[model samples]
Target: MNNPHQNARMTPLGRAEMVRRIVEEQRPVAEAAAGFGISRRTARKWLARWRAEGAVGP
Candidate 1:
């Protein structure tokens, strides 16, 4: 079976970098997801994980 999260890559970006791109660079979640070849939901999940744990998520 194919795992949806697998498509998301779960690359675990650095907290500072993620924050800079989301907050300062103001890149849309959908754009980020497309760049990573994933879905917007995946991008939002990554953002949430970053906010909660400061990175280090799957």
Candidate 2:
């Protein structure tokens, strides 16, 4: 079977970077989420993780 996460196209590091761009560049959350092919809720969750813990994923 295909790896479901492969279709997601973003690694843990990539998720960090995406959040960084959204925060550092003042990019819109919705735009970044769309660009990363993830839901805005997911993006917001990651951003929250980053803000609270300074890291994302394992």
| Each model's lDDT | 0.59, 0.78
User: What residue pairs are clashing in model 2?
Assistant: none
The candidate that wins on lDDT is 2
What is residue 19's positional error in candidate 2, in angstroms?
0.5
| lDDT per residue as tens, model 2, 1-58 | 1233655667777787789789899899999999889989989988887887776331
Candidate 2 — which residues are off by over 4 angstroms? 1-9, 56-58
Write candidate 1's Cα lDDT for 1-58 as tens digits: 1233554454344323554577578988777667666677766876786667654542
Task: Give candidate 1's whole-model lDDT.
Answer: 0.59
Clash count of each predicted structure = 0, 0
Clashing pairs in 1: none
TM of each candidate vs. truth: 0.60, 0.76
